[model samples]
Target: MQVSVKHSLPGRLRLLYDKNEYTSKQALLAQTLITVQEGILDTNCNTNIGSFLIYYDTHIVKENDVLNLFHALTGKYLEDPELLKNVDQIPETESIESVLIETLAIHYLKKWFLPLPVRTLLLWKSLLERCFHVLSKFAESKRLFSTELLDATAITVATLTGNKNTASQINLLLNIGEEIEEITKRNSYGNLAQSLLSADEPVQVVEGMDEKTVPASALKKDDVVVIRQSGLIPADGQILDGEGMVNQSSITGESIPIAKKAGDSVFAGTVLEEGEIYIKVVQTGKETKVQKIIDMIDNSQSLKAAAQQRSELIAEKVVPFNFLVTAATWFFTRNIVKTMATLMVDYSCAMKLSAPIAVLSAMKESATKGITVKGGKYLEEAALSKIVVLDKTGTLTYANPVLEKIYAMEGFTEDEVLTIAACLEEHYPHPLGRAVVRAASEKNLVHPENHTKVEYIVAHGIASTLNGKKVRIGSAHFIFEDEKIPCPESLAEIKKQSSLEGYSLLYLSHDGILVGVIAIGDPARPGTSEVIRELKNLGLEECIMITGDTEGAASKIAAECGIKKWISQALPEDKVKFIEDEKAKGHKVIMMGDGINDAPALSAATVGVAVEGCCSIAGETADIQLQKSGLDNLVTVRRLGMGLLEKINENNLTIVGVNSALMLLGIFGVISPQMAAILHNGTTVAISIRSMQPILK
Candidate 1:
């Protein structure tokens, strides 16, 4: 139980334990370390090195405290002689090969040791039970000759005619198919769920003005918590105090970090990229927004597209016709082989299996491309999307705006103007504000905290008091019209030049007079125009740009991106209305946006595409999420959708053509019932495999 300090930092410490002492109780020691009352943020055990890494909040707990706790826990473990024995009793995960071997051994023992009569009875009982189950399903659903019914009929005929081998073969193939389907589904759901799970590290919660570290699961609604820079928010909550930039990209599909101050809400699973804040928990556990998203993703298969639903319905309806075909064959040919052949060559098998396989395969492909398509229905919608609505900022344009120029009025020097602007702008997390602060940093300009607490006016500017003088920085509309600040006529030429050059303007004023004008430029993303052209080539009828920027700025960006139509000074509602109008006109809309303001429009579109790193709300509302912040993958998704449809059609045609040929061969006595069943089922399995193949290439 003895330990020594391996590494120590301000809020982190690592200790190495003796491998001979705690050889198998690393997990037990890890559990004990986390239970320490001192604010230990996280504990990680490495049995190989016989060490533990501890991260704690320096504000609440010190390095000495952690060392003392580790010593105490080790002493407790040494005092309890039975602890190691108890730890050894915990089960380890079984290997897949081991599980498979065990299953095969059990099966072999039952099959080889049993008496012939008993084996026959056991096999017949299993076959009859399966047959009756299928029959019961058919009776309840009123669908005849489905895959289940076809399977049951084939096995029942084999058993009745004393062809036990044929019955056994049919049952084995059915079980294999079911296993493949179940594994495929489990893998798909697991990938998505794992992607959305919150971090496993402990979070620091505020208890009566003092910080305490606890596991995220221990958090409850109304509890206050602290989120530091680069830490994941453990639960959905509202900010109580302080300010920070939160990256809700995992939830929102937008890559931009949003500025959150007091009274603003933040969700679990999102990371705090900069600054820190105290949050009052609003939701926790399964009730969190991320959990709701996971639940939606889990149930996404239920929201099937019209085509998928129709395919299923047609598969079911074709069941009765399959029975009729078998009956007709038996009556005319007077051949039991032909009747069984017709039953084996069921249309429902390929019809039901291939569609889902194709969809799931496409989903897997999309995931590899960093895109997550919620359901097959959204892919279908994307395939037919004609009108593409794009949000300007953080969508087509780069989220990181660069400071191009600054025009200072007569009384203020450029450095003085920039320093003051940076001082106020540093308080918020807006992209433009961050640009100004970044520009100041690059120039090695030092801007002390010279202003009072800044008040951010959403969609406007920031207001504060600097040296007892009124200071304001925001849009031209906010300064010139709302604040009644008069811009000097001498600066008109600078403003005009900036607008002509496609630069976004930010006006800075002090004491009711315009002091400076800052020009910010956000370049179009790399290959943006080429991607737009490619989208057009791929049958996108229209690509429009919508933004809250001025007409001149919007026009310049639209021209650069090869988009002919654009709407300037658009609000959240305007984007929503544009999508709604397109839908009303019978256009399947693909709305791509990356902001909290873009959520409503995303929801209204036929398929909402959220870019990588977008806000959490946008991700939840978006039908498709692009893990990479680019338009190239959008093209990939479109092609994938078309390929899925083509694959489904090809599978249908092959199933029909091959089965008909097999049925005719059976009728002429060229093929036996066993051969016909093998061919029919083999073709179904082959087509299912083909459907799962990559669609891109």
Candidate 2:
């Protein structure tokens, strides 16, 4: 238990243990050390060198406290073997393979070396236990031909007939198959969980203006951390000083790199794709937004699709019929052997196992391609979606909009209009707001807090007061129609000029009079038309674009994107109503958007997809989050879902056809009970493996 401190800091420590002393006990010691207090954030153990590192909150517990606890625990463990009882064994997941190998070898040896009476007794005992286990499941819910029932029945019949060898063989095969199934399921789920919880490499933290490398767990709120190009942001915080193009696909599922400068907010798990930034941490640990989203996804099983639930119910319901058929075979044929064979080939094994395997595998495959589908049900909806409703600004086009021009009315200078507009818009994160703020920054225009707190009206505009004068900025519909603001006849020509440019216009007003018009140019994303065509070819019957932009701008973008149906100046409620109307007409709706205004429609659709670089709210509201920036990945999701359905259907056919053939052969005396047991179990295992294969390939 001798240890030496390899490194030490205020909130962190790394220790190297005497390799010869600890040997295989490094993991046990590491686990025991963390239980010393709740201040320990994380611990890592390298058993090979008998070294461990601990990260803790110095504000809650000091370094001496942890070191003292570790020493005391080491002393106690060395003095008493009783204290090490529970920690002596390796974890089950770490040793399952070895355990299976050893068990198989021992079973083989006993089968050959043991006497017939002893073997028969052992086999009978195991068979009885298995049958009891199956019967116990009735307390929960009855499933007549469950794999447990099939296995128990097969082994019981063989043991009663004094065919001890056949009974042992059946039990061994079933046990091995079950182990393999458990391992496969765990591996698939583990792959995804690991991906989400994967730790980043040590990050550089600026402590009192001195930079040093430390584990991400060492980060605390308000700590200034320096992130370089391609470095993952260690925690959620605001940019204090520096600029970068941040790729937040990991957190928000957006693939486009956002231009982040001083005063802008960033999230943990996002990467600085280019440049560097020093962020003042606002939230760390499990309090970060990404962690919360991951927690939600982890617990989203309740959202399972109707089809998956039906498949499970059907699997269970067919079990009773399997038992009935076996009884009929025994009654009519008057052969115990045939009855045993019939029991061996029930549909429940493949039916129950293959469907979930196909679904989980498809989910894993989608994750690899940068799409996160919360559950299998959403995949079902994605495959069946007929009508796709798209939001124009961030979903169909890039969110990075440029301020093209600004026209000021009489009594207001262009700079004055932009300064006030920027001050108001900076409080919101919409594309238009960002465009105005960026323009002001580029022009070196400083707009201080010359206004009261801004009020954001979703799908409308920003309302605030500047120098006791009411000011508003938003779409033409919001300012002129909703707010009842009047556009002066003198500015008619200016409005006409802005409209002809095919750019989106935001109206700015002062005291109920339109004083300025800001033109924002956000071009349709490249390949939009091609993606729309591909979606149609893939069976999307209707494609529509809904936007709050002017009719001219919406029409121009829709035409460019090959969309024939376009709704202009539509409010958030209008988009929701559109989806509801489509659903009422028997069409399954898929909504794709990346803005706060799109949240309602996204939640109302059959399948909601949030594109990469979307706002946090949009990403959270959507069912499927696409990590890629473009629409190309949308097709991948559609195909993946369809592929899963196809694979499940194929597996069903295979299970039914193979089991039916085996039953016929057994009843006709063409195959023995032993052969039936082997073939049926082997087929189930093979199909289960096939179900886990990549759907796209």
TM-score of each predicted structure versus truth: 0.70, 0.67
lDDT of each: 0.75, 0.76
Error of 1 at 88 (Å): 24
lDDT of 2 by residue, 1-697 (tens): 5567899988889988776766445455444446445687776665545677888898888888777757765555544443343232222223346657977998899888999888888887888789788888865675445768877887887777877777788788777767766776665565554334323246688878689754465466888999986787867899998887786543432323567899999986566755679999998763353455445445545666565566677777777777787889888998888888787777777777778777777887887788888878888899999989988876787745678888888689999889999999888656567789999999999999988988977557789999999999987789988899976786677667766545667899998898898887767899999999999999999899998777777887898899999998888899999999989998899999877678888999999998876666677799898877798888898999888888888888898899989988888888887788778878987898898788886
Candidate 2 vs. true structure, TM-score: 0.67
Q: Give lDDT: candidate 1, residue 202.
A: 66
* Model 1 lDDT per residue over 1-697, tens place: 4578998878878888787866545545445436445587666565545677788889988888777776666556544554333222221222334444665565468678987788678778877788788878878987555678777887788778887766665665565555555554554455444343322346797888688765565577899999887788877899999887776644443444677899998987677877789999998763353555455565667767566676777778777877777788889988776677667667776778777767767777787677888888898889888988888767887655678899988699888888989999988757678889998999889998878889988557899998888999998888988888987887779878886766777889987788888998876788999999999999999999887777877887798899999998888899899989889988899999877788899999999998876766787789898878787878988898877777877877887788779877876778777677667767876787787788986
Stretches off by above 4 angstroms in model 2 are: 1-100, 113-118, 143-145, 195-205, 212-220, 225-279, 284-301, 401-495, 499-520
Count backbone overlaps in model 1: 9
Native-to-model Cα distance after best TM-score fit, residue 304 in candidate 1, in Å: 1.9
